[model samples]
Target: MTASDPSGPFRLLAQCPPGLEPTLTRELAALGIPAPHQTPMAGGVMWNGGWEQLLRANLHLRVASRVLVEVGSFRARALGELVRKGRVAVDWERIRAAAGGDGRRIVFRVSASRSRLYHEGAIEARLREAGELPDVAGVGEEAEPRTRDPGEAEEFPGVAGPGDRADAPGTPILVVVRVHRDQVTVRLDTSGAHLHQRGYRQHVGTAPMRETLAAGLLLQGPLEPDGGWSRPSLVDPFCGSGTIPIEAVLLARRIPAGMASVGFVPRDFACLHWPDLPPDVWEMEVARARAGIRPLDPERFAVFGSDRDARVIEAARANAKRAGVPEEVHLATAPLSKAPHPDDSGWIVTNPPFGTRLGARKSLRPLYAALGRSVQPGGRMVGWRLLYLSADPVLDHATGLPLEVRMTTRHGGLTVRAVAAR
Candidate 1:
C-alpha cells in the first residue's frame, strides 16, 4: 500500500491495436521479456514483471497504445457485495499514492455484460462508496481500438507532456472496471493519453496515419530483411505529414518512440505520479533508453517521403525535424504520378486515400493505377515491395499488382487491410 511496503510482481498489459498482437509480442521479446512471461491476446500482450519492465514498456514500446496494471479482482454478485468485495480487493492506499496523495479526480471507465450488476452507472456509484476514494467520473463510450492516425490532438486537458512537472492539477488518473458473469476486474491505466500521441505530430494533414500503426506496418509488413537491425530503404509516396517515414527512421535508429527527441517533447504517463515508483528508477531507465539510440547510416539505410500537397510537405518537414530525423527523412512535393523512383529497390509503404465517400472510389482508380507505374518507373523498383492500406480490394486490384491482403484492421472509421505485393 505504501511505497516502502513489499508488493508482488505487477500484472501488466500492453494494449495495442487489434491484429497487432504478434507484433507487440515480438517487440516485448526484443525488450528482453521472456517468452514464458508473455501472453498475447486479441488486442494486447500481458506479462507479470517488476517495476522496471513497466517503465521500459511505456518508455520504449512503439506499437502499444497504452500500458495497464491490474490492481484487483474479486467476485461480487450484487451491489452490496460489489461494495464490500471491491473495497477489499482494491489497494486503496496504492490508489491514493498514485493519485498524488488524494482529492484528485479519477476517471472510471466501467463496462458490464451478462452480469447481475449490469447497470454501469449503479456499479460506479457502488464502487465509489467502497472507501475514502478520490472523486470519480465516467469516461463515456469506451474508445474503439485505434486502427488509424489521429487528425487532431485529443489529449486529456490537464495532462503533462515530457519534461513538465507530473503533478499538474486536474491531471486525471483512469481506472478501468469490467464485470462479466459474477466476476469483477480492475485495472489502472498507466498511460495518460493514447501512445500514438508521441508529441511530435503538432501538425497533421487529412487522413494521416497514427505513429503506432505506422510502426506496426513497418515491423510486420514486407521488407528486404537486411541483417543486424538494419532496414532496407523505405519510401512513402503518399506521405501526408510524414508518419511512416518518421517511424521508419525511428525504428531503424533504435529511438525510443515515447522519449523526447530534439525539438519534440515527450508525453507524460499516469504511472509517473505513482508513489511506489522511485524517481531514480525512471531516470535510469530513460538514460538507458537514450543510450540505445544509434545513428542511421544513410548509405545503407535511406528513408524518403513525398506528398503532392505543398502545405502537408511543409508539415512533414517540421514533423521530421521535431522527430530528430530531419536529415534522414528526405521529403519532396510531387504527385504520385511524378514520384521519383529510388535507385535501389527496397520497400514502399504508404497509406493512400481510401476514397470512403459515396462515389470517390471511381475517381481514384487512375491514381491507384498511376501508383503502380510511378514506383516502377524504368523498372527501377522491380523487386521492391509495395505495402499499402486499402479499404477496397477493388481499388487494390486497380493497381495492376498481384497484391495479397496481409492484415485487416480499421482506419479512419473504415475497415482497411494492409495489402502487399511482395
Candidate 2:
C-alpha cells in the first residue's frame, strides 16, 4: 500500500552512523522488528511498519540518529516536474487527517542531483510553492516563493528541540526531499531532533561521543535486560561525557531511550501533534514501551567510568544524574594510566582522542601504548576486554593490546575502527 493509504504500512528509515548498519539491523530485530532491510546507502536501515512501530522505534532505538517516515516519493526530471509530482503525490490529506483538522507549520527541505533539475534552490522553491497550492497547508498558487533563508532549524537540521527545549514552538513537520540521479524521495522527520540528543549531556567535553553511536557500541554484546546474563562488568576508561557508561545503564535498566523525548516527535510533528490524536493514542504507546522495562536491581552490574579531566568528570556525573542514570554509573577523574579497571574481568569500551589536531598525532602512539600497558594481563586492570576506536593504522598497531578490527565506521567525519582485545 502507498503512503497515502491512511491505515497502510509505510517504510521507516532508521538513520545511523556508517558501518553500524548491521548493528542497527540487529538492534531492530532484537526490538521485535524482524529482518530490517538495509538501504543502498550509508547510515540507513529500512523497515516496513505502522505508526506504532514508528513510535516504538523512536522510543527504543539507541543506534539510530533519527526516524524518517517515507511520506511520499516520485520520479522527477525537472524542477517543475518535482513541484507537480510533489503536489499530487504527497498525501497531504493523509497527514492532515493524522493531525485531525488541518493547517499546521509545514517546512519544505529539498535537494536535487543528476537529471536536469540539479539546482537545489529552484527545487526547494518548487516544492515550497507546491505546498501552498490551495489543497496543501501553507502557500497559495500565486503567492511569491519565500526568500532563501535557512533559519536555525535549517542551520542545525539534525538537532530538533530536545525534550522540553522549544526550538520550534509551532510544531512544524520537516520534509526532506532527496533527488538522487532523478528519483525524488520525500520523507518526513518523524523524529523532531536527532535521537542522539538523548535529553542529557547538556554539558559536553571537547569531543563528545554521540549517544546513538554509544548505544551501537554498547550493543557489542547482549549487555541488556534481555540477555540471559545478568550484568557483567562494563567500564569506559575514556569516558569523556560518560556516554558509553550512561547508555550501558540505560540498557541495563531497560529504560526507553526516548523517555524524555515523548513530546518531541509525535507531539511536535505538526501532523501528528498530541491534540490531533485520540486522548489515549500516544499514552498507550508510551505505556506499552514502559511496560517492556524489566526492572533490574540497581546493583546488577559493576558499571563505571573515568577521565583525566576533573571538570569533565564533574560534567559526566551531572549529566548522568540528569539522565536519571547517575546511580547506574560511578564516575571518577584519573589519567589514562590511572583509568579505572574492573576487579577481575570486565569490558572496557572507550573512544580516545583521535588526534585530529595538527601536532596531536605524535602523542597518540604513547597514549595508546600507555593504555595498552595499563590493561595488560598482569596489571590491576588485567583480563579486561578493551574496546577502543582507532583511525591511523600506525597508532592502532602502537596500542600493543591484542585488539582485532571487528568493524570500521565513520565518527565525526573520520574513519574509525572499533578494535576489541579480549
Candidate 3:
C-alpha cells in the first residue's frame, strides 16, 4: 500500500546509537506501538506502522537518530539483476519528489555483506545506469573498497563536506540500499538531518553530548509520573553546552524534540517534502503535539546547569534561547564543587569529562570525588539520584558511592557506560 494510506502497513525503521536499543524499544512501546509490531536490532528498532505512526516516530522519538521507511525488497545476486529488479520494485517518482522535487539529485548509501554484489560503489553506479536513481557523480563511487563502522549513520547532505553537496539543484535525498545474503532492501531516509540536531544547538562546547542521548538519560530519571504528567527538577553539574538541562526542560514542558516551543520545526524534514503526503496531515500532527505542551512550572520544578567554563555557559544560554526555553533553564559558570543543590530533592544527570576528551584520569578523580560528596547518602543532595557517563570504572569508583552501570555505548571512539547511584 502507498504511504499516504491512512491505515497502511508501512515498514519503518527508527535508527539510534548502538547499545540504546532497549531504551528505544521502551519508547516505542510507550508511544502505543505494540511490542509484537517491534523488532529490536543492533542499531535500530523496526516496526510495522502507518502514516500517523511514521510522523509520530520522527516527531516524538527522543532516542532515534533518524527514521527510514522501507520502499521494497527483492532478490538479486548480480548487479544487472539488482538494477532490473530495483527499477520494478521501487517508486522512483515519489523518491524524486521527496528529494526536493523534479530536478533534485539522489545519493545512494549501499552496504553489502555475504552477497555477490559486495562492491557498494559498483552497486551505486549500476543503479544510476538503470535510470532508477538520479545522477550523482563521485557520491559513493569509491575506487577502493574500505571497511565502514556499522554504527555510523548516513552523512548529511551539506554538513559533511563541500564535495558532499549535490552538483544538481535542490537538496539530495539519501536512499539506503542494503544487500545481505542476495536480498536487496531499499529504504528512504524520512528524517533529513539527524534528530539530535534539534536546530537549537548551533553553538557547542568540546565533546558536547548529543541532545537525543541527553533526553534518553533524562527518561531514566524520576520525571514521568504514573499515567500522568509531573513537573520534575534536574541539574547537570558538568553541563557543557546545556544539553541535559535543555532536554530536561523540553521533556518537562512536553515540547517535541522536532519542534520549538512556538510549535514549528526549525529545519524541515524529508517527509514534509513528499508529493503524496497531504499538507493537512502534517498540520494536524503538529497541532496535536503543540496542544500537549504545558506551561513551565518554575515554582514546583527547576533545571540548573553549570560548568567551569564561562564560554560554554554562554553558549548554553544561546542554545536555550533558541530552544525557546531560555528563562526555564538556569545556566551558570561554576565548577562541580559548587553545583547547585535545590532545597528539595531532584535528579542529577550529566555527561562528565571521560579523560579521553577533557582531562587526565589522575586529575579527574578529585572532581568525581567532589561530585560524589554532593550527593552521597547523607550529603547536601541527599535523596537525589545521580547518573553520569563514564569511560573508566575507576573514575566511577572514585566517587566513593555505590554506582551501577545502567547502559554502555560508544561515543567518539570510546566505550562509555552510564553509571548511576539512586
Best by lDDT: 3
**Ranking 2 against 3 by TM-score, winner:** 3
RMSD of 3: 3.8
TM of each candidate vs. truth? 0.89, 0.83, 0.89
lDDT of 1 by residue, 1-422 (tens): 22111233788888887777777887887787766678886668888877788888888788788888888889898999988887789877766777775466666667787888888767877887885563343443333222223322134445555445556776667667778777887888887777787777878998888898788787755431111332367889899999988988887777788863684334577787787787887887777777777888878888889999999999999988888788989899998766665677778889988887758998988889877765464544566778888888778878887788777666556667788874
Backbone clash pairs in model 3 (N, Cα, C under 3 Å; residues 3+ apart or in different chains), count: 0
Instruction: Give stretches of model 1 more than 4 Å off.
Output: 1-8, 134-158, 161-166, 222-231, 263-267, 375-380
lDDT value for candidate 1? 0.75
How would you encode candidate 3's per-residue C-alpha lDDT over 1-422 as one tens digit per residue?
33233346678899988888888887787666766778888889998877777887888888898999988788998887978887888766566667664565576778888998898878878877665565565765432123555554534644322112222355667778888899888888887777777878878999888887787677664454111223256789889899989988887777878885334443467776676776776787778877877877777788999999999999999989988899899988987877775677777889988785345988988988888888866677777888888889888888999888888776676777788885
In terms of lDDT, the poorest run of 10 residues in model 2 is 148-157
Which residue pairs show collisions in model 2? 132-139
The lDDT of each candidate is 0.75, 0.67, 0.75
Instruction: Tell me how far the alpha carbon of residue 204 in candidate 2 is from the true structure, in angstroms, after superposition.
Output: 1.4
